[model samples]
Target: MDGGRDSEIAMGAYQPGYLATRNRAARGQVHGFRVALWQEHLGRDAAAEAAGDLLQPSSLACVRRMNQVAEKHWAMFADDSFRGDLPGHLMAYPVGVGSGGELLNTRDKFPDTNAKVLGTKSNILPPILTT
Candidate 1:
């Protein structure tokens, strides 16, 4: 698949793949996702590594290593994603008619919604800035 990029594209990689991208489109009018890293699932050595990696001066290596820890916790708590133990109903939403409502539970559905909310001219900031 052409160095796996084609697969990523096929799987909707061209979309707003990060929270920052979505927030930028909304002109900073967005509250970003809250990521609580639950380290109980990490073993002693891995936990130590994560702590050291996270505490180090911000760098690509530190960020990358911590991201691996986040990924592990996310996989374990996909339904909650570190929002604490919420009831099932709190995590569920009704599917809109014929709108692939089944996908609302997925991370890929926000781009279209963001476009509708922020792409409109009505949502634009005025060209002139005043104190």
Candidate 2:
């Protein structure tokens, strides 16, 4: 799972097997699921600046793969201000906060990795968001 301060501070709440930093949120990632950093700094250290005004630092954790499925589905429950699709196969909902992926059936899947975003030219809406 890839999440924010909540995931970093209290990962036990999410219970993810392999975790990444969700670069879009915190600008960091796990290397081989071993090491994690909030953000990479060159000559000077900017951990404080990069952290912005967060109350806590970002999280870094790892473990063996937990769930193994033939397919993966991603979903998002983010703040209302967020206005875009998730980085991976995940889709966003105008709500709370969550990251990473979850198991789902094919019929209930959001979208496969190959799914594409629709534009003005396409009249059909993505079924992922439809019930």
Candidate 3:
């Protein structure tokens, strides 16, 4: 018998292995985005002003990098070579005094990488609030 049947008998649950794998892939994508964001923002050693221009916290480039990471995760998920699903976990951010401020999601915040890779505009906003 396949492992799926054994798992079901042992846990008294019917696990959707395919769906679980897909979810894992999705998580991987999100993780990639986090890494890309960090690299784009903190990977440089330039002056503050120059870095500001290149790595705007809310620029499209930054967002694109995040999306690219997600895409890679998706690819890995679709690949049959990976038997298990990707792990589900949240991407953590460093907290500081000035770090918790809200970022304005404007068109400028969309990364150019979206157009280059995904071939369309990416709706990557985490939901907006007006106060």
Clash totals, every prediction: 0, 0, 6
Error of 3 at 33 (Å): 15
Writing each residue's lDDT as its tens digit, candidate 2 over 13-120 gives 232553435553322233322122222211013223333322123322111110101011122322334456432321222123235554323332223333323212
Q: Which parts of model 3 are misplaced by more than 4 Å?
A: 1-55, 84-131
Q: Worst ten-residue run, lDDT, model 3?
A: 88-97
lDDT for position 61 in model 2:
15
C-alpha TM-scores of all predictions: 0.27, 0.16, 0.25
Please list the C-alpha lDDT of all candidates, in the order they appear: 0.37, 0.27, 0.37
Using lDDT as the yardstick, the better of models 2 and 3 is 3
Query: Residue pairs in steric clash, candidate 2?
Result: none
Output the lDDT of residue 98, model 1.
45
- Overall local distance difference test of candidate 1: 0.37
Q: What TM-score would candidate 2 get against the native?
A: 0.16
Better of 1 and 3 by TM-score: 1
